[model samples]
Target: MEIVQIVGFGLIAAVLILVVKEQKPLYAFGIAAFAGISLFLLVIGKIDAVIAVLENLSERAGVPSIYMATILKIIGIAYIAEFGAQIVRDTGQESIAVKIEFAGKVLILVMAVPIISVIVDAVMNLLPTGG
Candidate 1:
């Protein structure tokens, strides 16, 4: 059933791309992007299920919850950044796309800071302190 839906959508997207290519190139790009987003949303339910499974596995394996959350956050940020960059590029705003990518990187770094600080603090605590 899922495969059928995916193939059906893929075909529709291909046809839209071809039609838009002849008539409106920009709109062709837009349609392509819209198709991608639509497909993503369609499969988002599977993502939730996968996350639940991963959470269960991580708990059974004694993995830290924070680590799992951080990984998921990173994945989310990467996906969003890529999507934004592609849209900007499609709109012919290369400079803005570059800035958007830079901003995404900065945001990811900021988000990771807490994990980094924790590691740094742990290492520092392990060092012998001279009185």
Candidate 2:
């Protein structure tokens, strides 16, 4: 459907860039960037549905809404960081991309700390310490 068309066009754009890059590197760079952005924008159309499903699943699992929200934020940070890193790499800035990825990992870990603490607390409660 729409996704098929978007993928098809994205592939065509990629191929075109590859072909065009040999003679016009500047144009190729712009085209590659534009293609990447367009694909991301197209995929964004489905993000809402995905988020809704996650929320429903989280509720059904009896998990706290705050945990679910944090998880979603972590996921958002991951995807944005990955996307940013990829774009930076595509522009030949591998060092910056690595830094971006590192930052993303750290942020994700930070966001996960509360959930980890909750798990640790639950396990501790179940341990049944000696009186």
Candidate 3:
């Protein structure tokens, strides 16, 4: 299975990183980052396939392209921020990792505002208004 290969690759990288870490901390970080990116690259095609399926389903459901795009962007931001945070954390920067996550949350919130407002409007329309 592909998962087995990924796990094996990850385990090998982990061992290599651990071995190098004692003598070369910087290289250890580099190894961790490179491994993380390589793993991401391996799954990128699957990510695209998922996006395509979601887009197809959204179209069938009559969802606006803008909403779908926003949702995808939010997902992307979360993944990228977490990835960056992990890389920074590998370098022993916990504070910076936290900041990166915080920034991602803020950006997600900003991107979500329009969708939230649309939902609120829909709900308000369903309520009875006093004449």
The model with the greatest TM-score is 3
Best by lDDT: 3
TM-score of 2: 0.88
Instruction: Report the C-alpha lDDT of model 2 over 25-109, residue by residue, as the tens digit.
Output: 8898899889888888878778889989999999999988999999989989998899889988988999999999999999999
lDDT of each: 0.85, 0.91, 0.95
Instruction: List, residue by residue over 9-34, the lDDT tens digit for candidate 3.
Output: 99999999999999998899889989
Q: Which ten residues in a row have the lowest lDDT in candidate 1?
A: 36-45
Order candidates by lDDT, high to low.
3, 2, 1
> Candidate 1 versus the native: TM-score?
0.73
Cα RMSD, model 1: 3.1
- Each model's TM-score? 0.73, 0.88, 0.97
Instruction: Give all candidate RMSDs, comma-separated.
Output: 3.1, 1.6, 0.8
Backbone clashes in each candidate structure, one number apiece?
Answer: 0, 0, 0
With a 3 Å backbone cut-off (N, CA, C), the pairs that clash in candidate 3 are: none
Of the pair 1 and 3, which is ahead by TM-score?
A: 3
Model 3 gets an lDDT of 0.95
Q: Which residue runs of candidate 1 sit more than 4 Å off their true CA positions?
A: 1-8, 61-67, 127-131
